[model samples]
Target: MRIATIGTGSIVDEFLQAVEQVETAECIAMYSRKLETAKELAEKYKIKSIYTSLDEMYQNPDIECIYIASPNSLHFDHAFQALSSGKHVICEKPFTSTVEEAEKLIALAKEKKLFLFDAISNIHLPNFKLIKENLALLGPIRFVQCNYSQYSRKYNQLLNGETPNVFNPAFSGGALLDINIYNLHFVTRLFGSPDDISYTANKHPNGIDTSGVLVMKYPNFISECVGSKDTQGMNFVLIQGENGYLHVKDGANGCRSVFIHTNDQEVNLNAQTSMNRLFYELAEFEGIVQREDYSSCYKLLEHTLEVVRETVKARTDAKIVFAADKR
Candidate 1:
């Protein structure tokens, strides 16, 4: 997959690095509002093309896919344009600001027969798959607690009255979408959508969540997902069951390590090959796109849609509205 990227953020840098590890994937072009910003990243990665206009980048026949790492609000616009331009898209997570936008993008992808992926890295990790495979050992899950909290360097900027894209409601930036979404994906991907959902958050003056706890109730289990950008803590996931439990180190984002405790014995496991969590996801995208596997692509799309639905519902329940919601 010859990928072009449409952002100059740190995530874009990570995505480019991950592309290097995937043999089938290469980032050939980059688009940013400013050429200078994109130039730094392009030079670092040895990318030959950089464009300040989306039209120019999208017209390049050499660009087979567009990796979007824009702000949450722009995800829909960027992905929609890429898909309309006949390019496959890998949009960064918190896929879009609203369920309607996600649906529209999915519909367009299907209609155009193009691959559309939400750039969710965790669920595609080898260790994450290993955790899923061993979930049966836990025996009848009862409860799940996932916490992913890292004090954002941008949070200080927000505190100083600078609205960083992440802490700004207009940009669809908040703890839920920005930091804690990994927990949502980890629990939902393993157990499916919850029976009920509710969210409570520590809100800033601009009505964005600085930190929040989302509670999801299932038929037999209850899961609490805590995501915070205003604070830091030990990030981990604990899945308790009738017979035993599984402890996931480094929260849902990395799936760095797993420890299983059973009646007979206890075991620790880590199956990830690359330290860059984004590597696994980009590699998977490369294979799927190479094989033109729409069935597999849409399966992941369905999962992403369900997560977006839950996210929208959670936001509605908490009355945390974004600019996209108004639109």
Candidate 2:
């Protein structure tokens, strides 16, 4: 798939590097507000085309797909433009600031007959697939705990009175959307949406959550997800059941390995061959587009919509509002 990437963030750099590893995908163009920034990434990735304006980038006929890694609040606008211009979109996770934005983008993609992907890598990882295959071994699940906490350097900037986009409510930034969403994806993708959702957060002065615990109540199991940007914590996921339990190493963001324990057996499984988890999702997306598998794409898109709904509801439950909420 020929691609043009938006944004020059660190995540975009990772995406470009992962693209080099995928034989079916190549990033041929880049779009950034700054010419120097776009040129730097383009030169690094051997991309020949760079545009300062999104409209110019979207007009390029060589771009079969647009990979969007813009800020959280801008996801909706960036993706809407791409889909509207008849280009497939691989939007970075947290799909959009609100459920309404996600729904509108999905509707546009459907209307345009274009592929729309939520760039969530964990669900597409090989290790994640293995965990699903062995989830039945745990019998009846009782509880799940997922922790993905990293002390963000940007948090320090916030403390110093500088509002980085990650902690700024105006940009739809918070621990839930930035980090906890991975836990949401891991749980919801495996068990579907929850019966109830609530979030308790440590809010900054500006009403954005710096850290929080998200509780999802299922019919039989209770899933607790902890995500923090204010402090560091042990990062892993534990799934408990009546029979045994499954332990996921490196948390939901990276299901690096899985430890399965049953009554009579214990096994450690790691099916992922590459540390670049982004590669798996990009390759899968490329294949879906190549085969024109709209059915499967929409199936995954529905799952993305569910995650978005859960996220919006949970954050609302905590009374943590973003600038987008007013819109």
Candidate 3:
């Protein structure tokens, strides 16, 4: 498969390295708003070409897939363009500003018979899958908690009247959108959408949420998600049940190990380090593209849309609204 990636950032480089690990996919080009920046990465990766305009990139004859690592606000536009151009899309999360945009993209991808996957960084992790397999050992499910908080250098800049995409509301920026999104996906993949959601937010002086705690309630279990940009915390996941509890000290993504405590017995599981989640995600995407698995594509898209809806509700509870949602 011929692939193209859009963005000129450090994560984009990391994504390239991950994609490089996949054997079936070939990156055709890298696209950036700055032609020289895109060319630099293309040369570094031995890509066929580079283009400044997305229109040109979409028109490339050899391109069949696109990986969108652009700003949070640009995901809908870029993914929609790729789907319209008959290319599969691997979009970074949060997938869009609202559920409506996600649904529209899903419909478009269906109309074009293409794949549109939300490239959630956690779901593809080996340790996460192992955790799923080991859920039975923890007894009946009860309550769950996930916290992924990191102090951002950009938050300091935003406080000084220097607003960038990471902390600016115009670009749909906030700790909930940038960092907490991973926590949301982590639970959504395990338990699907919550029955209800509530949020406690720390609003920055600029009217953006710098940190927040999101609570999602289900029928039998409740979950707490903590995402932050203004402060750092112990990134961990704790799942408690009737018999015992499972502790994952390393958060949901790039997890290090899992420990289950039941009765007088304790079980420990350590995942291998070299198994990058992106490697598996890209390989699975390749298979979906080759097989025309519409059912699985639609199911994943529906799951992504559910997450978007829950996020909107959490933001609303915290009194956070992106400008586009008003329309």
**Model 2 segments more than 4 A misplaced:** none
- Model 2 scores worst on lDDT over the 10 consecutive residues at 32-41
lDDT tens digits, residue span 229-273, model 2: 999999999999999999998899989989999996889999988
Candidate 3 matches the true fold with a TM-score of: 0.95
Candidate 3: tens digits of C-alpha lDDT, residues 40-108 = 678788888888888988988789899998988889999999999888899987899988898899989
What CA RMSD would candidate 3 show?
1.5
**1 or 3, which is superior by TM-score?**
1
Cα lDDT over the full model 1: 0.93
lDDT of 2 at 164: 95
All candidates' lDDT scores?
A: 0.93, 0.94, 0.85
Question: What's the lDDT for residue 149 in model 3?
Answer: 88
Which portions of model 3 miss their true places by more than 4 Å? 271-275
Q: 217 in model 2: Cα distance from truth in Å?
A: 0.3
